[model samples]
Target: MIWEIVLFVSILYLINIVLLTIIVFKGPTIGDQVLAIDGITYGSIVLLILFSVYFKEPILTVVAIPLALWVYALDIYVSKYLERGDLGA
Candidate 1:
């Protein structure tokens, strides 16, 4: 039962990623594109975690945490660059 639920949710995340990819490409502004990218990354993390649970592979869950941090760092640097015209790092 739980396995089925995980599979279903993973499928939902996959669909979400596809839609977010379209939004990333067609967004009218950079802010919208960045937001879509963030969404895509988060969805990917969820999928990774789900797959980790479904497959009993702990490494994918480990990978997801650093990926989440990377996404956060990307958000910070992009915001800094947009505001200050430079990453300063």
Candidate 2:
């Protein structure tokens, strides 16, 4: 039962990755590409958490928090750069 759930979630994550890759490469605009990259980062975070559960290693789960924070920072930095053409305000 639990194994089935894990398999299902893993499949979904793979599908998400494929779709995001398509969007990242063929998006109509830079904003669309950036959004797709952000989506990929979030999907990676979810995968990390899922892997931690499947492996029964609580310590592995700790990595996802910092990864999430880093992705958030990246989104902010990119948005700022796009809006102002500079990273520094």
Candidate 3:
């Protein structure tokens, strides 16, 4: 039963990643591309947590928070760069 749930979740994540990749590649605007990349980052974080549970490895889950924070910082940096043509304020 647990294995079935894990398989289902993994399949869903795979589909989510495929769709996000398409959007990232073909999005009409830069904002849309950035949003798709952010979604992919978030989906990867969820997959990391899911794999940690499936593998019974608590340590693997520990990285998700920091990964999320890094993605958020990247978003901020990109937005700033887009706005001002430089990463520095």
Candidate 4:
């Protein structure tokens, strides 16, 4: 049962990767591309968590939280720079 769930999630993640790749390349503007990249990053983090569960190791799961937070922070920082032309200075 658990193995089936893992297989299902892995398949879904692969589909998401293909879809996001198309979106990233087909995006019309820089902002759209950035958004697509961010989406990919989010997907990667989710995939990592899924992998950690599949492998039954707590160590690999440690990366998931930091990866998610870092990507979100980067998104905010980049948006700020784009809007104001400077992050802080």
Candidate 5:
């Protein structure tokens, strides 16, 4: 059933989150930390979609879109800042 699939995906996502949290703590460089954070953001979006399906709420799917875009843009901004050493330059 769809519910079973959603539950499996949710569990996998949680495991990934835990692993990524460890990576964030052990990341060797600033860029590594940023990348790990991005990964977590993406995982959260997937988890949100799973919840949306489980709860039969169509609006949460729409919510995930903006969150995904925001996280991606934030990743770009951070990478740019890291590369340029200045946010406004």
Candidate 6:
């Protein structure tokens, strides 16, 4: 049933979270940690949408999109900072 699918996806997401958590804490370098945080952000976004679908909550869907975008913007800013010395011209 639909619950089975949701359960499966939730388990996978949980595993992803665990791995990302380890990388975020013990990653060898800053770039690796940043990428791991990005992955965690994206995974949480997907998990949010999935739960919204399961619960039939439109508000959660609405919330997830903006959070995802914000995470994306932060990721870009961080990557730029990592690549270049400054965020300004």
lDDT of 5 at 35: 81
lDDT of 2 by residue, 3-61 (tens): 67986897799789889999999989988987888888788788878888888888998
Question: Which is superior by TM-score, 1 or 2?
Answer: 1
- lDDT preference between candidates 1 and 3, better one: 1
Task: Give residue 12's error in model 6 in angstroms.
Answer: 1.1
Q: Give the TM-score of candidate 4.
A: 0.86
Best-to-worst ranking by lDDT: 1, 3, 5, 2, 6, 4
Query: lDDT of each structure?
Result: 0.92, 0.86, 0.88, 0.84, 0.88, 0.85
Per-residue C-alpha lDDT of model 1 across residues 1-89, encoded as one tens digit per residue: 99999999999999999999999999999889989999999999999999999999887688887888998898898899989997775
Order the candidates by TM-score, highest first. Answer: 1, 3, 2, 5, 6, 4
Off by over 4 Å in 5: none
Which one wins by lDDT: 2 or 3?
Answer: 3
Q: Which stretches of candidate 6 lie over 4 Å from their true place?
A: none
Kindly report which residue stretches of model 4 are placed more than 4 angstroms away from their true locations once superposed. Answer: none
- Residue-wise C-alpha lDDT for candidate 5, range 1-89, written one tens digit per residue: 88999989999999998999899999899788878888988898899989999999988788887877887888888888878978788
What's the TM-score of each model vs. the native? 0.92, 0.88, 0.89, 0.86, 0.87, 0.86
lDDT of 1 at 62: 85
* Model 1 vs. true fold: TM: 0.92
lDDT of 6: 0.85
Error of 1 at 76 (Å): 1.4
Name the weakest run of 10 consecutive residues (lDDT summed) in model 6: 58-67
- Model 5: lDDT equals 0.88
Q: Pick the candidate with the highest lDDT.
A: 1
